[model samples]
Target: MTSLFDPLALGDLTLKNRLIMAPLTRMRSQQPGNVPWELNAEYYAQRASAGLIISEATQIAPLGQGYPGTPGIHTGEQVAGWRQVTDAVHRAEGLIFLQLWHVGRISHSSFHPDEGLPVAPSAVKPSGEVLIADWTMAPYETPRALETVEIPEVIAEYAAAARRAKEAGFDGVEVHGANGYLLDQFLQDGSNRRTDAYGGSIENRARLLLEVVDAVVGVWGRERVGVRLSPYGTFNDMHDSDPVALFTHVLGKLSDRGIAYVHMIEPRATSAGGGDTVQEGVPCSSELFHPLFDGVFISAGGYDRDGALEAVASGRADAIAFGRAFIANPDLPERLQKNAPLNPYDRSTFYGGDARGYTDYPALG
Candidate 1:
């Protein structure tokens, strides 16, 4: 039986255990250039016991900023700032990967310079609100459609960010193609209505993601790259007409590239009351992906200790990423192994705040 504590090798890197710390956006970066600081280092270092830590979604360029305080890897100063974080994690003998992100239509105009509209594959306006700098939940704005000539520049930006992540000492980079962000906006047909080569068929929709992956791999090599996908996620008002087919095709392409791993967000049924019907977009089993991709498969979203153990033991997932659990318990792998009680996470301080809920969580003594 494969236990959660067992070591696993992801590409050229070897992880100590199967419990990975998921990329969580705490919105606590330093303001001037959205740079990471020592405080962020301390927070990640405290949780270094995990097999691998995927840093929060980091923007690849100024045009990628969706929310305030999220870190960026584009500038020299930002690269230097992240060096502190990677050094701290390394000193603690932990491996880390940076998640590259671009928000696309899941953003507001205020975050853009000159109040320019956010960009997406198409000019579709998603139905929902976005969390901005001041903690205000503002209505979504219709994003400007990207011109075909400009697509290569965005792809190059991701490649540049991967180089910076390597310069800052990260073991690998995970492309943020999930969570209704820029890549997801293009992958799903609901938001992408472009008639050009970048849209229409599933292959066309997946083109940008594959291009970004190839670009990043060019910098870090295929073994040091990963990609995340949310097949049935409804967050940020995202829905794919055919998730299983779309993801199976996408995963097939990723397997051909021989990248490191694929992290997937599982489905959680939602309802207003006890008798209300569950939301229609339930996801297929993670086991279905095992044969499709020839690399590590990680499943996230509302996993408990026992459930995670079962998933890995049954060969459904190579690893399990704990989001909220890791937030409260810095030593989550230890806590899970001992079956120790966990510290409850404060809901209010989840997004933007000082060190109150950020680094103040006490690990088991």
Candidate 2:
């Protein structure tokens, strides 16, 4: 049986174990430039024991940002800032991947360049409120539909971001296509109501994501690129008429591309209460979609040690990504290896905070 501690070949890199630190949005980047700083470096370096540490979701361009203090890969300063983080993780003997992201309609105009409206595949308005630059909750506004000609610009941004990640000293890059973000909005039918080549059918709907993947792969090659997806996610008021069909095609295409891995969020994680709240009887996205992808399969959700062990041992998932658990336990892999009790995480400081909930968690002595 494969244990969580077992080493696994993941693309060009071999993970020392199957415990991955999921890309968590902490919104703590330095202001004015959304650049990562020394504090961010310390937070990631503290959790360097994981098999792989996927950095917080980083916007590929200024327009890609949706929340305050989130880091970006677009500017020279941002790249330099992330270099500090990558250097720290490497010095700690850890491998890390930067997750390239675009929030689309999940954003408010205040975060946009010149306060422009958020862009999406359609002009639909999402149901929830978004966190703006001032840390206030504002209702989501109807986003501007991207002109068909404008999409190539978006694809180019992803490629540019991948190159920036490389320059920043990351081992690889993961395209953020999950959790009702920009790519997710394009994938599902509820948010993407377009008549052009970018939407309408399953193939068309997945076109942008695949194109972004191709662009990123061009920069990092197939072995160093991965894509994250959330099939049954309802967060940000996202839905699909036929999720299985949509993701089956998406996963199959990604598999055919022979990329590094496909990270998926289990349906339970996007349940009504919260991402960490587990809903009973929800199907595991990895179990349903892992077989569709030929590369490394990583599953993220509300997973305990026993559940993670079973998922890997049973071959349902190749590795497991932990979010909230990793937030509260920097030495999570060591603690799990010894079955030690985990420190409870504070929800209040999960976002837009200082070192309190970010790096203040004590490791096992």
TM-score of each: 0.95, 0.98
Computed on alpha carbons, the lDDT of every model, listed in order, comes to 0.88, 0.93
Error of 1 at 130 (Å): 1.9
Question: Candidate 1, which ten residues in sequence have the lowest lDDT sum?
Answer: 269-278
Q: How do the residues 128-209 of candidate 1 rate in per-residue lDDT, one tens digit apiece?
A: 7777757688888888999999999999999999999999999999999987889999999988998888899999999999
Clash number by candidate, in order: 0, 0
Off by over 4 Å in 2: 113-115, 271-276
Candidate 2 local distance difference test against the native: 0.93
